[model samples]
Target: MSTFLTLLRRDCAQLLLGGRRGGALLPVLFFLAVAMLYPFAVGPDAPLLARTGGGVIWVAALLAAILPLDRLIEPDLELGLFDQFALRGISEEGVVAVRVLAHWLSFGPPLMLAALPASALVGIDGAQLRLIEWGLLAGTPGLAALGVLVAAITAGLRGGAALGGLLVIPLAVPLLVFGAGSLSAGGEAGLALTGAVSLVLLAITPFAGAAAIKSSRG
Candidate 1:
């Protein structure tokens, strides 16, 4: 029990402090950048911007998810952290579970906060902002879980970061569909579907991540 807490603590430390490639800030910055730039590219048509903003946010969030992929599992593997956990009789699944939680902590809230400013930039109002928030809440878990799974799978491969990013896009299409769909449709069904997908991914991530790590090690 203590070990699990310790691992979780360490994972949090890595996210909040020890970030190798870029800290937790990178993804948030990327997300905001995307939101900020779209107004310039598409021209300042208010209704058009408001109408398309939700989907833009969804796509930005999705790409933000990809930012941490290369650093996700490979750094821990390269540092022999997993080996130490194995030596201590700790299950890789537990480590991966902790990692998932930590990753979400680093990725989710900041993006949500950034979305407020992003919402303003893209001409989204309070009501649409609320939908975006709800949709992100329901969907980001799935994104985080998917990111971890893809990271584990591609950790040791050549050009794995790029590949991982590409791989996650298709896997995350469900999230994008339901989450973005909720914006215009204003229906609970989309949020429910998004939550369901998130739950399934979260349930399976620990085991799937563990297996991927093991196979990559072999």
Candidate 2:
């Protein structure tokens, strides 16, 4: 427990420092802005806007989750920081888990915030807004975990981005399906349950990714 806390703190420190380096927050913000344009481009029909907002927000979240992965892990691996983590008495699994958590924290909350205004623009009700937030919260962490694993595997490979995308897209399918589909339905509990599944999927990702990274590192 203490070790995990220490690792989480260390990873948080590294990510916070990275923020000072600039360009870190830009991609998620850009994604949020672009997602808002979809409704305006479709024009000011309330039904259409409401219908599309949830799907657009979910899709935008997935893309935003993927955006930072390549850059996030590549720099660390290239500069030998990942290797340093392994050598510093931290378990490789812990290193990978902390990295995933950091990436998710950096990318997820801003994307969530950015989604709110877009949700309003799209005429999302309070209930749907809550659902969208719930879905994103549950789904993005899984995406982040998959991102970490794929980023690590493709770290030094040529065409790594393409390879990483291929690996992650299949894993992301369930998240996309349940997340977006749940929004269209009327029942709150059913939608919430579906959202819960997505969250569980997100929670499970780091464990699998950590094991894979550990095996690969060995």
Report the number of the highest-TM-score candidate. 1
> TM-scores of the models, in the given order?
0.97, 0.82
For model 1, residues 1-218, the per-residue Cα lDDT tens digits are 89889988888888755546576888999999999999999999999999999899999999999998888899889888888888989999999998988889988988999999999999999988998999899999899999999999999899999999999999999999999998885465898999999999999999999999988878
> Which numbered prediction scores highest in lDDT against the true structure?
1
In angstroms, the error of model 1 at 112 is 0.6
> What lDDT does candidate 2 reach at residue 142?
70
Q: What is candidate 2's lDDT per residue for 155-176, written digit by digit as tens?
A: 7678887788777778777778
- Off-target runs (Cα >4 Å) in candidate 1 are none
Residue pairs with backbone atoms closer than 3 Å in model 1 (clashes)? none
lDDT of each: 0.91, 0.71
